[model samples]
Target: MLETVTSPTLLVSERRVRANLERMAARANRHGLALCPHFKTHQSLEVGAWCREYGIEEITVTSLRMARFFAAGGWQKIAIAMPFNPREIGELQVLSQRVELSLFLVDSKGAAKLAAELSAPLGYFIEVDAGYGRSGVSWRDHASVRSIIRAAGHHRFRGFYVHSGHTYDAKTIPEIAAVHQELLDRLGELQSAFSDLHPIMAIGDTPACSTQEEFRGIDRIGPGNFIYYDLTQVQLGSCGLGDIAACAAVPVVQHKGEEIIVHGGWVQLGKDSLHLPSGPTIYGRMVLLNQDGQWDTSRPMGTVTKLSQEHGTIHLPESLRAEVRVGDLVGVLPVHSCATVHGLRATGDTRFLA
Candidate 1:
């Protein structure tokens, strides 16, 4: 199967993906939290069907386009997890009529606009910033929170959507746990202050979801990256290296001394990189592809040292450098699976192994 690949190709492991979905679903069930797995990681309709096999009815996406894609694929309960963009009101209006739609709003102005423009009864979650600092109204800003909820007008107030992305910066599992606990405490305060509305507390971010066992105040878990654990997840101790389900199959084009150049680069793997403690940053981890089109994770080949637009430089260890040839197909486990999937999806060159 590897012989058929002539360029960069994303190889998804069906077995690994099912195992990942089952694990996350079981984790949610054990804690009695609704598992609305985010579908932004694997944007394929076929992957969404796999998610349903595990009884996932609700899902969260990052954009209106994704919501439309999954809604057309038959997903009824959909939430656009990004901050509400007023520019897409027309598109949002059309989509809200088709499915039970929900979205995130950081400010009351956006909520008021949605309330006035759309009469389709949409649900809205106030985006709360626990510590990620990227987006969301500050968790401490109770005034803004109240204003947003009040501005909902006729739209249903669905509670808070917290993505504790800061957990991704943690260097240890305990650090990740600490960040998650703090987030839960903040959510607890929000829930108490808004108990009258009975808002649902939706928290997500693979690092926190995968590491922390307790979700004291969270109502739903919508982590997307867990479906395809990558090198970053493994580095953060969220999952073992073997749990990674996606690998880019790139044809070895040249062997330059200790470095092997492949046909995969930023356009195929994206620019996401993992900075190692050993002083070097790597774009991805290389694995040996077996004859059956499956990667042998136990025998990691090397690290992708660099990536250009259409070329990747891999640095193999002395012992394994002699094993790879120019014509061989090398498997690259992405540093960030979400970005990698988006990159490959843009080129329309992804395949799943049955």
Candidate 2:
């Protein structure tokens, strides 16, 4: 569909996205849970529309701007999936007016104070630090949790939310399932406490949602990475290479010595590092392209060997370099889908389906 697709062009596959979405959605449905997929990973209006096509009415986002984007795209229910930032209060208020905005409140007192000042009725979910130490109220800190909840003081409490980001490091499926259950059990206890006030429990991260089997008390599941199953997702056992929904379409600009250079540099794909056992300098992986626009496995090529601000160097066998020439388009797999998104511009920020 992308006729002019060339170097550094990021493309998402419709079939793979639909399949991954259906698989995850079915898993949640079987357990009677709602899938409120996170929108920050893809950040595409078209991908947002695909989420809706799969019956995802409620969604989660990492920023106020993202929430605004999806709301403008016609999604009426959205949750801002990060700690409250006072500076975005005006944008949040504007989004709240158009759609129901569910804000994350790690500090109950701070959220209550902010909520009181808002001009409209707002809902909130207390962010609990299940295992990830990023930003959340400690799961075991009951007194702090109670104090924070009390701080709400009649302000609407939506429910409890937790994102088990630590699951990304799991080397095995069993390990990932273990972390999923652990998160659910911790959130379940808090859910029992405020049984009548709020009724939804939101947990995200593709690794947990796509692999784990037991999702009993989770009222809603939010997974964004499934849209474009990246190399990270594949390494995490989330999906296979064919399941990758998004990829970078780049051109081979040169074939020097035993290295191949592509127009796609860190500026287009990002310098997301993956720490391998031997070392820690892999920027990304390359997908060999055939004449018919398919991946050629015979020529594995090389990894994204090095990256400067504007150049991407690939180290491979000298034989492969001779075959690839300038003006040839190649596909580079992303280590992290979110980091790849940072390379895109304003139009790249949101790609919609016609």
Candidate 3:
């Protein structure tokens, strides 16, 4: 299988991926929380099937297109984690009839509009901005939150969906725990305030989901990146480097002294970088591929220091640089596996290892 790689290919390890899924499922079960894992990471039906093996029937996707893809693939319960877009109402209506579709609502206006236009029966969750200012209604704004819930007139108000994405910026496990605690505190207050509605409390984010053990108020978790731990996860103390299940297999194109250029670039690996403490940024970690087509993480070969449109430069030491040649298949453990997979899949260059 290692010999067959001619271009930048996204390689997935079934063993590692299953282990990751099983671990997350166990975590959710231990806390008595429903695991509606976000499938926006791998976006592979093959990977989604693996989630079923662990008793995951509910899933969360980033878009309606992804929801349709998984719905056609037999996922009966799906949640579009992104904010509701009225422009996709036509497709949303079709999808709602096919599956138990749920959507995220951040504003009362959007909810009111949806209530008026939507004829199909579906559930909607209020996306709370729990310190992650990227989107969602501010957790501090109870008036806005209540307005959205009331505006969700006919649609079943599911629960609050909080993505404490800021946890990713934390440097330590304790920092991640602090973010989780704040989220729990906010959700607890929301649940208490809206006790009459009986809303389910839900939260999703790889950092908080992976590190925190006590999900005091969370009813459902939809972590996606945990399915394939990446360098970013490792840096955030969510997972170790050995737990990363995805790698970009690119052919060695040239050896320029200590730098080995590979066919993989931003087009294949994306531009997500990991800033090292040594004052340099790296796109990925290099590893040697064994004959069985698996990456060997035992030996740290080098780091992908630079990436252009069609090439990546791996800064290797003298001893390791001598071991590779042009046309040899080398592996790069991605900094952000989700973005990396998305990039490779866009070019139709990805393979799953059985």
Candidate 4:
């Protein structure tokens, strides 16, 4: 049933993509919040256009290059969620003139320096750590945050923004809600502390955004990975397999015992792994596809147990070995959608995205 496909390919279901976008947009609108989805997920101009169909004019991207790409693609407002890049000062200055550009600031001194360097007006947000253990001002670093907020005097201060990454560690919905409540409480305190400034809340990260039903005081939510929910999101209970919009199609090349080797590997999908319900840690789950190459949600065949640079070996049960064979095309759902697409864009063939 899969003889024509000659190489590894990432297949996206337009139906699921649109449905995900609309679902998030509606949810944000219901909560009276802005859904500026991160464009770093798909990075395709075509995908950007799909977002526009839902009346999403404001968007988020990781780098200045992506900001410019989407800006030229007709996105009216863009927030570069990453830290302000000194190397792209010139490009940042240019992008600000063309669109409403925003960046993340962690240091007061750095904020002042950027305000002085940027020729055009720009918006800025103080990066709040929110227990992510990554970049951002720690919730307890009130003194430093105050200094940065003051230093961002001339520049447009957007407010306190955070990537609710701690929710990623949560394995259940209750755990996700607990982390969300703590962040919300901290955000509330920030709002009151800076009452004179009246900053808006910008909370992001897909785990909390998708699982939690409430948004107490959030002004905007940017859940990037929800566009293509992956194995990790499923394990975290953010979404189901039916909600996963993308799949990788690889040509099966060998069968050693019960394992089926495919042409796709780490370069095709990222090295992210997840422990499945069946109690096996695998890079990606072997998914089934309909005749149209769309995802078949009925069942997953197995898991990609081992991966080399150009080969992935999936462990299938004896009952399903005959159902799949060498020279056939198999479907895989990556563990992390973000890393997978980035890998494809970074090292795959030029025609990979198409």
Candidate 5:
């Protein structure tokens, strides 16, 4: 089946992708929340267009380049999920003129400076740290959060936003709910303290959004990775193995005793991986594809033991290795789909599966 494909290709299961989108859309609709799926995962214009079919118009992006990419594709409502980049204000201004622009800011440092240079009306969401210890102003740091809000008073204030990325650390649905509860508690306090603003709340993280049945008061959700659940998401209990939508088809390049090397590597799949009890896994897990172009997960294919620039070493049980051979196409389920797509796109090593 892969006889015609010579290069490492990134494949998307439209069936799975659509299912993921529909499930999330229904969840958001139940609570009247906007499902602003982040486009940084599947950057393809085709995928973005498919999202529109699911009633998703609002979108989130990680960089200005991405904003322009999606903006050029006619995505009218876009929120730059990352802090405003002073370096690309020109591009941002271009997008603002063409589409509804929203920006995220973590501190008061550049808020006023950015506010003064806006070429268009913008909606600003102050990022609050939801005890994730990542970026954003601490939830307890009301002073900083308010300062950023005040500093960006020139814009149309949207509200407060929290990523809750730490939810990915959860091992079960209850753990995810626990993290989400903390986020809600933090948001509740911040909202009450600044009651005059009546700022809307926005939270997103696939683990929490997919596990929790309800979004009590969230105005919008920015779940991008859920469009292509990775192995990490499966382990976090955010999704099942079947929910994963993206995989890279790489050709077996060499065979060394117990290891089979493939043409895929960190350049094909991103470096985001987990060190499990088996050992330190680098890139992804290998899957054998069926005639229908889906992974035959009824049996495990192998796991990528090591990865480098353009090579991946798959270490499988001897029984599986003997069943597979060099020159064959091996499907690799990346650890992180977003980074994998970014790596594939960045290196121009990409193609779609039929």
Candidate 6:
């Protein structure tokens, strides 16, 4: 039955996407903040249009390529999330001419110089590393920030942008709240130091923003994962299993000892793993299917116990494995829906969505 459907299309239900957008917008409005969702997660023009339906005109993208893609699609206010790459300065200039473009700068020296060179009227965000340890200037590094701002000289300094990706690891609501508050407090200090600068403290992530209390002092909240909450969101307490907006239909191709083999594997779903005590892990949880294209949580349809380049091995019970024959379509609940959908190049190829 599954053989009739083409592979690699990511299907997203319009209803789920809207529900997530409405909830986020309401939450932000309640707390006095604008919602500028990140487009890097899905990067779909169709989904981007969906965001506009909810009064979101401003957006954040991870690359200049994404900026070009959406700008041509009609987005006006855009903040390129990552630090500016020198190689892309020309593209940035072209994008700036079309829309209000903002660049992220971590250090004072490099950013100051770039701001001086930009041909168009550009905006700036102090990319503060609020304990995430990945990129950005440290919140405590006052000297570094002071230099960057001074270097900006005359450009529009739009305050700070911090992504607390570490919040994904928080075990409790209190933990998530604590990290969120700490990051905000750091931004608060910067806001005070640069009072003339209209501070737009921006933060992103589904767990920290959705699972915790109202986020204060944040001018804009960028939550991409909430649009398609997944199994990881459920485990992190950000969302329930019912909120997951995306899934893949894989073809069951074989049956081994207590296992049902499928063609869907790491490359299809992603090579993501859950942090199990035994050791590192790969693949995500699996969901069995019914004729209605919904979740059948009846049996351990497959453990997703193993995978290779193009094949996934599902460790299943003898009774269930016997029921699933070759060419059967099995729905998979992704560990992270964002990673799963980003892999799909088109929407028409996914059977579950159509």
| lDDT by residue for model 1 (267-317), tens | 989999988889899999998888766888777469999999989999998
Better of 3 and 4 by TM-score: 3
Model 4 scores a TM of 0.94
| TM-score of candidate 1 relative to the true fold | 0.97
Which run of 10 residues does model 1 get worst, by summed lDDT?
292-301
Write down the TM-score of every candidate: 0.97, 0.91, 0.98, 0.94, 0.94, 0.90
Q: Whole-model Cα lDDT per candidate?
A: 0.90, 0.77, 0.90, 0.82, 0.82, 0.76
lDDT of 5 by residue, 41-63 (tens): 89989889889998988898887
Off by over 4 Å in 4: 1-4, 347-354
Count the clashes in each prediction: 0, 0, 0, 0, 0, 1
Span of 10 residues, lowest total lDDT, candidate 2: 345-354
Residue 255 lDDT in candidate 3: 88
Q: In model 4, what are the clashing residue pairs, if there are any?
A: none
Pairs of residues clashing in candidate 1 = none
Cα lDDT tens digits, model 2, 196-241, are 7665888888998888788777888888888777878777788887
What ranges in model 5 sit over 4 Å off? 278-282, 348-354
Output the lDDT of residue 154, model 1. Answer: 89
Compose the digit string of candidate 4's lDDT tens values, residues 1-354.
334457787777788888888888888889999888888878878777888888777888898888888888877799999977677888788778879988999998888778778756688888888788899898778899888877766888878889988898888999999999999998888778877777878888998888777898899998899988888998899888788887888888998778889998898888988876677788988876566676576764677999889889999877778888777778888899887777766655212221
Writing each residue's lDDT as its tens digit, candidate 3 over 65-132 gives: 89999999999999999999989987899888889999999888888889899877679998989898
Give the C-alpha miss distance for residue 106 in model 1, angstroms: 1.6
